[model samples]
Target: MKTEAEIKVAIETYGDMIRRICFLHLKQYADVEDIFQNVFFKYATKREAFDSAEHEKAWLIRVTINACHDFLGSWFKKKAVLTEDFSQFQIDPHSDQGHLLDIVMTLSPKYRDIIYLYYYEGYKIVEIAALLKKNENTIHTRLRRAKQELKEKLGGDYFD
Candidate 1:
């Protein structure tokens, strides 16, 4: 059995990174808490036989990203409306980030995931390619396409 110390170490090291990944996927306050709980639960189950720390961290991140995808698939939510309110935002009041996020949600999954991992998670394009298990060229192309798509949907005048 893995000791509690090992589990504690993983949480301390990668908790926020995992949380950001989960938020990117689930994108709902309630769903986030549920997913967060699920991540730790799964970790405990798997920790019965411990791997190296590097292996464990990578596994945790991979599972968090997959969990988000699974959550989205199971929910079957429709495309986001452009009219959602942004009053809950507390940063860059003049910056219209929420509207941009709404526009991003309307994007194709390929684009949205690339953008989330690259921008929100601060993963380099190369790092993102490794994590998502896609070719470097493919990640580059998708990121370019995702940005172009977002700009078109939001228009140059949005939130300005």
Candidate 2:
């Protein structure tokens, strides 16, 4: 188990990123909170040592993504009435950023993940492929497709 200070530092550093990933995947605030806690709990209990800060962040991102997917795939999620609570987001729905975010959220999870990691997180395609355990070419293709979709939705001027 990681020391209390270490865990605290980890949470302080990555909490917002994890929450953003959760929100992207789950949409609901309640589910985001649950997955956030679960991801940190896993981090606290993890036995392996990270090679670097980047490695640690990547690990956390992977765990958060997996946890969100698991939570969404649970029987409870399927049975429950899931309502989107965008109020948790600070962006105004009418604003351009908010409008873009809305369109991004409307994408399928795979496209959303690619867009979030590539555009929002500033990760390179190679890094995203490594983080997602996919081929570099696959990440490149998805990113192109996602950008194309976004461009179509937001107009060519937005991408240009």
Candidate 3:
């Protein structure tokens, strides 16, 4: 177990990163906050002793991703579709970042999630695989498909 001070430092240091992970996964403000809380809740409950800062950060990210997966599963079962695949968006530059997020949202959710982690969150394929609990090859293939999908949605300028 870490000292209280050490744990506090971890929370302070990693909290924003966890929040960003949730935001990238869910995109909705409320859902992102819920997943953010779930990340800390899992930390409080798991009771596993971390070997290092890197371990703690990875564990937090893993839990955040799992929580988002759970959220998506329950969400689809319970609710009507909240928005269309694309075009319902207001083109808010911060959220959509011009047309990129719009194009990303058009992707099937599987590819969208991987692309969000890879491009928006700056996670490498190996790191994204670990965070999303997917095989590296799966991540690679999804990334390729995601780019192709975006290109189709955004026209040839997607690469330019």
Candidate 4:
């Protein structure tokens, strides 16, 4: 069992990253919340000590991704095909940033994940490749293709 201080530190350090990963993978807020809770629960219960802070963050990311996959595969999730209305929550009415996020969310999970980790989470290609356990070249190819797809979808040189 992990100590309270350790659990608290983990939560404070990686909470946003975990939530962002969950949100990117899941469509519904309810499901995201469930997976988010489950990820922390798993962190608190797991016994392995991380070799470094980077290792700990990577482990959390992996666990969060796995939990999202598990949630998607659950029988209840399979039976329901619900989607959330994004209009209910808006931080800024005039910001076009939300539109970009909407476009990214339209991507398939593979591309969406790579985009989120690379662009949003500030991970380099090498880092993302290592985190996702894919070849560095594969990450490069996916990112290139994903950018093209996004460009086509958004039109008029959306990415710089």
Candidate 5:
């Protein structure tokens, strides 16, 4: 297991990114918090050393994605009907950024992940493909389709 200091450093470095990924996938503040803590806990217990900071970040992202998927797939999640409080998610719907986020949230998870990794995270197509474990061509196609869908929904030159 990693030392406390190491775990603290990791949390400090990637906390926001992990939380965003959780929120993107789960769309519940409670789930986001759960997965955020779980990710760090896994990181702390992980025995292998990463090759570099980038590798560490990539590992964390993968873990967060997998954890979210697992959570979503759980029977408990399927059965639970807890009230969701969006206020904790903190997107101001009146703002342009919030409007874009709302639109993004309406997208299918596949497209949403591609868009978030490509545009919001500033990852290149190749990088996104690697991160998502998808073919480069698939990533390219999804990006194109996602942009088109967003454009249609926004009815503006938002992507450009």
Candidate 6:
């Protein structure tokens, strides 16, 4: 069993990161909570040692992503509209940052995941490809395409 201090540290260090990831994939608070707990539960139960903090964070991220996929596959997941109201998920919906997230959440999961990992998590294309088990070229292509789509969705002044 992991020590309490370790668990607490992990939660403190990565809780918001995990929450944001879960929120990106799931809209309903209940679903997000379930997946978020599942990620930590798996973390608590796993007995693997990490080479570094980065490795540990990467493991948690990968597990959290898998947990989101599992939740989506579960029978309990309702097939509701993908773009439900995310006001509660935002820190400040009126702000431009939140507006950007609102736009990002409108994207399909493929684009959303890539964008989050690339931009929010500060992972490079090659690193994202490795983490996601996709070809590096595929990650590059998706990022390029996703940027174009975001630009179109946000109009010409998006990055300005």
What is the Cα-based lDDT of residue 72 in candidate 5? 92
Residues 1-160, candidate 4, lDDT per residue (tens digit)? 7899998989899998888888778856677778888888998899988899988988999889888988888898889867667646433435688788778888888898899888887899999999889999999999998999999998968777
- Cα error, residue 93 of model 3, in Å, equals 4.0
lDDT for each residue of candidate 2 in 104-153, tens digit (9 for 90 to 100):
98888888888888877899999999999999999899888888888899
Identify the superior model by lDDT, candidate 3 or candidate 5: 5
Go through the candidates in order and give each one's C-alpha lDDT. 0.71, 0.88, 0.72, 0.85, 0.90, 0.85
Q: Considering summed lDDT, which 10 consecutive residues are worst modelled in model 6?
A: 78-87
Candidate 1 regions exceeding 4 Å error are: 1-9, 48-57, 75-95, 157-160
lDDT per residue as tens, model 5, 72-158: 999999999987566856788899988998899888888988898887778899998999899999999999999999999999898
In model 6, pairs of residues that clash are none
lDDT, residue 142, candidate 6: 88
User: What C-alpha root-mean-square deviation, in Å, does candidate 1 show against the real structure?
Assistant: 5.5
User: Residue 122 of model 1: what lDDT?
Assistant: 69
lDDT of 4 at 47: 90
Best by lDDT: 5
Model 5 ranges with Cα > 4 A deviation: 84-88
lDDT string for model 6 (55-87, tens) is: 898898899888898888877675655566655
Q: How many Å off is the CA of 142 in candidate 2? A: 0.4
Better of 2 and 6 by TM-score: 2
| Number of the top-ranking candidate, with TM-score as the measure | 5
Span of ten consecutive residues with least summed lDDT in model 5? 83-92
lDDT of 3 by residue, 40-98 (tens): 76676666688886777778877877788788789463685655354343357555475
Q: State the lDDT of candidate 1 residue by residue for 66-138, as single tens digits.
A: 8877877773445544355544632343566755666776777677778877777567898778877999999
Model 6 misplacement above 4 A: 79-91, 157-160
